[model samples]
Target: MKKFTVLVLVVIMTLGVAGSAFAVETLDTNDMQQREERQSKASNRFEAMKEFNDEHDQIRVLRIERNHLQIERMEKAGVIYDLLIIAWDNNETEKLRAAREIRKENIEINREIRALHEQVRTARKEFKENVKAGDFATAQIHVDEVIKLLGEINRHNNIKVTNLDEIISVLQ
Candidate 1:
């Protein structure tokens, strides 16, 4: 009788522990599902931000190219200005929001090129005017300024191209 009683007690204890373990397992599964959902949401947000950043960068490139053409035309006309309106326009609030967490220093540098461009335009215009007015000495001063500005811009453009090439190489 004692042996039978002990067997029953052992059986009861085993069943109790197993029941509690099952309950804990269910809770753990629920927690895992919740964690998965949160991770999915975070992943979606990251993907969306990356997509937006890429599109914004494309638009920036287009604008930069347009501004470059304008600069070329102005240079031919002996005009210079550091206008970065193209960069400003390409940089909408959405672009800023999406790009805040990404590597954006290169884009920023390209955008800032506009300011330098405007200064060059001003100097070029003065030089052209001096030349047309037959003020050789004044025109020569303006020419020197133009040369200096162009040199700076050329160096900057070379650096930009090299950086872009490096990035492309890494991507490839």
Candidate 2:
């Protein structure tokens, strides 16, 4: 009986030591791989985020450049519109001086401009009134006359400009 008990105790002690050693080995090898994989995935995610942010910033820069170009174009259009208006006015002044034999820088240019402006204002006011009165025919006539006056005053007479109205429309 005593020998049998000693043998059983020794077997239990051996199994306990062997089982603890196996567990320690498994934890070291397997858990090291799991920890390393987790770190690798985290690094990959960080790299992907950085790439996405770089693309986003590039898009913002492109949008700013586009806005700058649009602003420059609009400003240029405004300047051209103003210059064309001045040229049209000068053409009218020249026509008056030559037709009426008015002295240059002496008089009549400003007065002529005022009279012509008044004509345009009267036409426009009549057009508006006719429209409000539902007289579309009269309104159309007045508007057509206004267009004729503009054409006469602002004609370039150059084949290079086949359509002057379109230029004014776009610039305006």
Candidate 3:
């Protein structure tokens, strides 16, 4: 009778241990599934942000190109102004005609610059709106892109614009 009771108790303890082990395994499986789901969702979010980042980068490039064009237009205007001054001082008919032609070109360049500026303004507004709506990660991406663009602009123009510095500061 004593041996038989000991055997029964051993079997009961074995069953209890097996039951707890199974429960732990089940919990681990559920935890792993949850983790995988979370990871998938995070990946989707990152992919969407990447697409937006690309679009924003393209817009930034367009803006930088427009800014460079504006600088070219300003330079042309300055040249025309100098020619006009020379024409007035020297009473030269050829210089005056050349100045008038440059003025016409300058007017056309000014119109194009204005249109480009409006487009840039629209892009900036959209970027600001996105940042304000709690898309800080994407905004940071845009900020980095703009910083790179500013560096390129400075290199091309050989001068740093204070307004660009202000913009970088605001983004930071």
Candidate 4:
């Protein structure tokens, strides 16, 4: 009887151990599935964010190019204005042509600048919408892009202003 009781207790303990191990394995499998799902979601978000950033950068490049073109247009206008002034002072007949050309070019540049401003406005609106929708990762990317664009604009404007000042001084 003593031997039989001991055998029964040992079997019971082994079953208990096995049951607990099975439960733990089941829980671990479920946990692993949840973790994988989370990782997949995060990866998708990262990819989307990366794509948004790339597109934003491309737009910024185009904006910078447009700004450069605008600066060149302004410089050209300045030179032409100077020529017009000289022609007027010397009673030259080419003053009318220079004046008309400057006017036409200035009008075109103004239109281009207006269009670029509209593009920027649209971008900002979209950025705000993203932020409001809780896509902060994408919104933050847009903010960074804006900062970079602003920096470029500031640098360009500074140089243009200095050059304009020099030209004005020379003319005076």
Q: Provide the overall lDDT of each model, using Cα atoms, as 2-decimal numbers.
A: 0.58, 0.56, 0.59, 0.65
Looking at model 2, how many pairs of residues clash?
0
- TM per model? 0.38, 0.30, 0.36, 0.41
Mind giving the per-residue lDDT tens digits that candidate 1 earns over 6-84? 9999999999999999999999999999999888767655654453454446435654765685565445323111212
* lDDT score at residue 9, model 3, on the 0-100 scale: 100
Ranking by TM-score: 4, 1, 3, 2
Q: List model 4 lDDT by residue over 1-172, tens digit each.
A: 9999999999999999999999999999999999998887777667656756766676577667757756875785577578658766877655455445535554564465456456556767777777556577777666666655555554544444444444444444
Q: Which residue ranges in model 2 land beyond 4 Å of their true spot?
A: 54-172
lDDT of 2 by residue, 1-172 (tens): 9999999999999999999999999999999999998887676556544534544464356446545644654665566568567656767554333423322322333455456557767987996676655566686677666655444333322211322333444333
Clashing residue pairs for model 3: none
Predict model 3's lDDT versus the native: 0.59
**Ten-residue segment with the worst summed lDDT in candidate 1?**
76-85
Candidate 4 scores a C-alpha RMSD against the true structure in Å of: 13.2
How does model 3 score by TM-score? Answer: 0.36
Q: What lDDT tens digits, residue by residue, belong to model 3 across residues 18-125? A: 999999999999999999988876776675567467666765675677577568646654554565566678777765664455445545644654564455456556
Backbone Cα, N, C clashes tallied per candidate: 9, 0, 0, 0
Clash pairs (backbone) in predicted model 1: 80-120, 80-121, 80-122, 81-117, 81-118, 81-121, 82-117, 82-118, 82-119
